[model samples]
Target chain A: MVPLSWYLALSAVLFTLGAVGVFLKRNIISMLLCLELMLNAANLAFIAFSSFFGQVEGQLFVFLVMTVAAAEAGVGLAIVIAVFRNRETLDVDESNLLKL
Target chain B: MTFEQILFILFAGIVVGGAASVLLQRNPLYSAFSLITTFVGLACLYVTLKAQFLGVVQIVVYAGAIMMLFVFVIMLLNIRDEDTAVDPNRFLVYLTIPLGAILLGALLYVVTKVNLAQPTGDEGGTVERIGTNLLTKYLLPFEATSVLILMAVVGALHLAKREKE
Candidate 1:
């Protein structure tokens, strides 16, 4: 059987990769994709702990997290659509009217 | 050495590789496709964790529904590969290298220290057990999530609605 630490290490690696992607990616949609990556990494950790502790709470939390992710995706994509409609671009740096 | 370990490595490799592709892909459509692979790999990982219900839900909700929405938006926007914008805060990209290394190291240190005794056999993960818990102990939060979903639907409808001329 694989040790719990290995699962956790993978989760850590994934989360770091997502964080770095968020920092480096210029596209708003890619940033959103990275956000989903981070969420999945967290869900992986929760499930690993749930199985390790033999508790359902962590699984339940993951359920809630999934629910939230669904909601976030809906609203986030809507915002993306609206932004693209107005700005005619999906680039985060190009939509810097607020900085002006 | 074991089947489960091999499966873990395979799925983990797919997940990590897909996620990296998602970040590296210049086209949002390609990134969305890569994200689907990542989600599917995570679903397999969930099943291996014995959370069969979540594994199914991860596929249905994330890979099926959410990713479809992503691909739909990417197509609707007609985002091409060359549309990728220049990074104004280019220095932040370099800064993330050190910060992410520190973050990963800290998380690994903390998790490696968890040496709890192996869990004795518990009730195997089942829809019945999860459903019962959802209705009994977690009913309120479950209900709240419905409201949250409703709000999201309404908000998306409003936000994406065509503005009156």
Candidate 2:
């Protein structure tokens, strides 16, 4: 049987990749994609733990998280589109009008 | 190794490999395609973890809906070949190596310390059990999630609508 630690390790690696992507990628859309990756990594961990403990709570939590993630994606992409319309560029460095 | 182990290995490879490609690919379209593979691998992993409902939801919400939105936006944006770039700073590029190593080290340490006792594998982790838990123990999260969805709808509309000139 595959060990739970293995799953956790994989989740951690994926999460790190996503986090790094968020920090390094300049494109707004790519950054949003990275955020989704991070959310999925967390969901993977939660389900792994729930199954390891033989409880259904974690699965239910995953469902809740999925709902939130979908909503976040919608709002985030709309913002990206709106910003692109005005700025004519999705580069993160160019989106500094709001920076204080 | 058994069939489950082999499957786990394959899915793990797909998830990690696809994610790396997503980060490394120069074309945004290619990155989006790679993200789909990552999502599919994750959905399979969810199934192996006995969260059948969650697995289906992952596929439906992430692979089916969210990814489509991503692709749509990419196409709508019409990002040309001249738009992309690899970051130029050597210092920043090198920093990722050590940072990633440290994060991986911390994760490995925590994983080693935890004692994850395997399930007795008797009771099926059924959808009925999940439904009951959502109504009972997880009612608050369930309600909060609906609110989150509502907020998302409003926020998306606000974002998409043109500001009053």
Candidate 3:
């Protein structure tokens, strides 16, 4: 039998990797991808809990989360594209126009 | 360990490995591909968790829709591997490593602390139940999300328009 703890541990590791990517990577798109990774990691945990606890609420929450993630990615990529058009580079360091 | 357990382990490895590759890769396009693999692995994980509807949704929405958008943008930008700027801040790297370690430590601590007893209740997480709950109990949030998506679409149009103008 696969233990729930194993799933939880895997989720935790994935989340940590995402956090590292978010913090270490300077590219806006890369950071956004990492953010998606983190969200999926959380979704894994939610589904695992739902299965372990035999409740549908956790799964329901995962559905809501997926919707929100899609919305977020749409808006975020739009912003990234806009920024890239003006700056010609996706590197965060070069596009500090708002740094007053 | 049984077949399901082995499959679970294989999927977990794929998910983690793909995510790590996304993080470590220099090319944005390569990272996008890795991310797609990660999504596929995640969908499989959802299946192992008994969320059949969610698993399909994960593949359809994330792997199919969202990943295609990412690939489209990456291709549209025509970002080359050599285009990336090199950062010389070794100190930032040092700082992030320890900070990430601390965060992971805290996460593990919390996970170990929780006593997750097996849940006993109705298998209420099916598509029908979710749809019913969304229309009835969580109707407001459901409507709110629709509004949010509408706003995002409008915002994206606005942003795209400014570039042409």
Candidate 4:
């Protein structure tokens, strides 16, 4: 069996990669995809700790996380479309207009 | 290494590799493809962890519904390969390297030191227990999620629908 530590390590790496993507990618969709990656990493940790400690609540939280993630994805994509409609570009740097 | 360990490592590799592709790929469509693969790998990991429900949900909701929505929006916008825009800040680019190192260092430190008692078994992951817990203990949150999802649907329609001048 794989140790919990290994799973934790993978989650950490995945999370970091997502963070890096968010930092580097200018496309809003890619950033959102990276955001989903980070959420999945969190879900991985939730399940890992849940199994490590033997509890159902963690799994339940995973369920809630999924629900919320779905909600987030829908709204995020809608926002992206709306932004594209107005800005004609998906670049974050280009979209910045309220800089004060 | 045992079979489970091997499977875990393989799936983990797929996850990491796909995640990297999602980040490094220049095209948004390619990144979307990589994200789908990453989702599949994550779902498998969840199943291996005995969270079967989460695994299924990951497939159905994430890999299926969410991905389709993303692809549709991408098509709707007609985002071509040339539309890809990467950040221009050199400092931010360099900053990621050290950020990665720091996060990795912290992760290793914590993962090595944290200890856990052996689990009793698959008591928590069973569908029966999960269902009961959802209905009895987690009922409120479950209900709230449904409402939240409904709101999301309405909001998405309001935002994405053509606005009248």
Candidate 4, A52-73: lDDT as tens digits: 8888788899889988988999
True contacts kept of each: 0.69, 0.64, 0.59, 0.79
Candidate 1, residues A1-100, lDDT tens digits: the string is 8788888988998898899888888888889889999999999999988988899988898999999999999999999999999988887877888894
List candidate 2 segments past 4 Å from native: B122-125
lDDT-based ranking: 1, 4, 2, 3
Q: lDDT of all the models against the reference?
A: 0.88, 0.84, 0.84, 0.87
In candidate 3, position A43 carries an lDDT of 95
Candidate 2 lDDT tens digits, A1-100: 8888889989999999998787767788888888988998888889889888887777777788788888988998899889888988888778898899
Q: How does chain B score by TM in each prediction?
A: 0.91, 0.89, 0.89, 0.89
Q: Which lDDT tens digits does candidate 1 get at residues B1-165?
A: 999899999999999999889888877788889999999999999888888999999999999988898888878886756556546558887788899889989999998987654377766457888899999999999999999999999999999999999
Backbone clashes counted, model 3 = 1
Question: What is the per-residue lDDT of model 4 for residues B1-165, given as tens digits with 9 covering 90 to 100?
Answer: 899999998999999999999998988778988999999999899888888878888899999998888888787786755457564655788888898889878887888776676476455587888999999988999999999999999998999898888
Superposed on the true chain A, the predicted chain A of model 2 yields a TM-score of 0.96
In candidate 3, which residue ranges exceed 4 Å CA deviation? Answer: B82-86, B117-124, B163-165
Off by over 4 Å in 1: B85-89
- The candidates' DockQ values read 0.73, 0.70, 0.64, 0.77
Using Cα atoms with residue i matched to residue i, what is each candidate's TM-score against the true structure? 0.95, 0.93, 0.93, 0.95
Lowest lDDT block of 10, candidate 3 chain B = B81-90
For every model shown, the clashing-pair count is 0, 0, 1, 0
| Deviation from native of the Cα of residue A100 in model 3, angstroms | 3.8
What's the lDDT for candidate 1? 0.88
